[model samples]
Target: MNHLISRAGLGILVAVAVVAGAWARSGSGSVTAQAVLTGLLLGGVYALVAMGLTLIFGVLDIVNFAHGAFMTLGMYATALLATGAGLNPYLSLLVSVPLLFGLGYAVQRHLVSRTMGGSLAAQLLLTLGIAMLLENALLLAFSGDTRTVAVSFDTPLRVLGAVADLSRVLAFAGAMGLAGAVWLLLTRTRLGTAIRAVAANPEGASLVGLDVRRLHALTFAAGTACAGAAGTLVTPLVTVEPTAGELFNIIGFVVVVLGGLGSVPGAVAGGLIVGLTEQLGGIYLPGQSPLLAVFAVFVLVLLWRPQGLFGRPA
Candidate 1:
């Protein structure tokens, strides 16, 4: 009961802050619209990445530090297909998604499965090591050169009085669709029900004839596949390099926490909030780093609800 009240209080506070901020910047209507649109598009991608992280954490209780690395691999895969075979960047998704899914399933089955029920430190270290290995391997193979997929359709279009590239629009649309699909899979499918059962209580799930270990692997694979798809989605918007996923790693964690670990809807809302905060912060602060606002909001939310906005009280 107290948790509910506290959450409501925080929500009200946040709402007030947003209204106040908007009122303060009411004069810059066009600029505000541009920021809102841009933030929303960027937030969609962030939500895609966070959805995977949240799923793994919610179900397997694994803090997958290597998620961004998986995304990096996806970016490289898409770029390679585009540059080498002259495939359209979007067409590369058919290959990259499955490739990532297989890689994730293999890694979970052979590697990550060993550390189940172990120390949190062990899991973190193992995932961190995985991240490092993938990054270094990519560095060796690609020599740290930034790569891009050539696309001729990236023409700028006016959207609600704000200009945006076609690629960004498409990326945003694709991400939202994928995120929704994941949501439906979780809420409507047998696999999702089994996964949720395991997440709720592994021992009970096992007693009920469910294969917990297999479910864990499946969840992890799904999570990694999300990272990979996100990477492919953003290939046209960002540079592909060995360390490209590093920043996203940070942002993913932030979004995961902001949305409440394990809550899909929370992740989506948090992504939009973080995205808007970043864009509007630039406009309001003028010279400060946009991330400063994101962190500020993060800290405030943590202070108010450490379990995250959508997370239940411990």
Candidate 2:
């Protein structure tokens, strides 16, 4: 009951912040409505990114610093396919997801698995090295140039008297759909049960005949595939650059911590909270970076509820 109330309270606070920020921005009812709607839509994408990060951490107990680099790879892959093969950006997901999945599985099986029982520093350094390598490879291939997927659905849609880009709405819808699918997989499927069992106790799972290493690899691959899907979804909305993944990496980490280190649902809630903070901060702080506001909220959340809004007390 307390957890439910806390969640509800957090939601209310975000709602109030959105309303107050919009009202203060221009005192225009339409503008305020637009900001709120835009914030919510963008929040969905953030949730998708954070969900990938949280899943890996929850299951594997490893901080995947290269997660965003994988996302960059996906962005490039989608861009190349969409532009070179004349495929629709969304259609390219068929290639991007599997490609990233294979890459992730190979990396975990060959590199990360070697450091499983070693010091945390080894794992961190290894993942960090992988991130650097992927980013630089992208730089060499794409030359730091910003690219975007050209899509025909660039028109704006009106909702509650507020205008929203159709692409963003579609991204939001896709993110939500994917999140739902993941939740169902985790809760309803046998594979998901094995993954969760491995997460809970690798030794126990191994004793029970589950291949712990395989599960770990599979979980990591699934997480990376989510990043791939996110890359494809955002290709039309943002400029795709090699370094674009860095910002997402930072945001994903923040969401993971803010949501609770290993809580999937908490990650979703944290993403929405961060989205609201960014939009509201943009309005209230006018000239400052919106991330400053996000960091501020992050600090307060850490101080007040270190386990996160939905996390149980340790």
Which pairs clash in the backbone of model 1?
none
Off by over 4 Å in 1: 1-27
Alpha-carbon error at 25 in model 2, in Å? 5.2
TM-score computed on alpha carbons, candidate 1? 0.93
Tens-place lDDT per residue, model 1, 22-138, is 647756667777888899899999999999999999998988999999999999999998889888888888888888888888888988889989999998999999999999999
TM-score of each: 0.93, 0.95
Q: In candidate 1, what residue range of length 10 has the lowest lDDT sum? A: 15-24
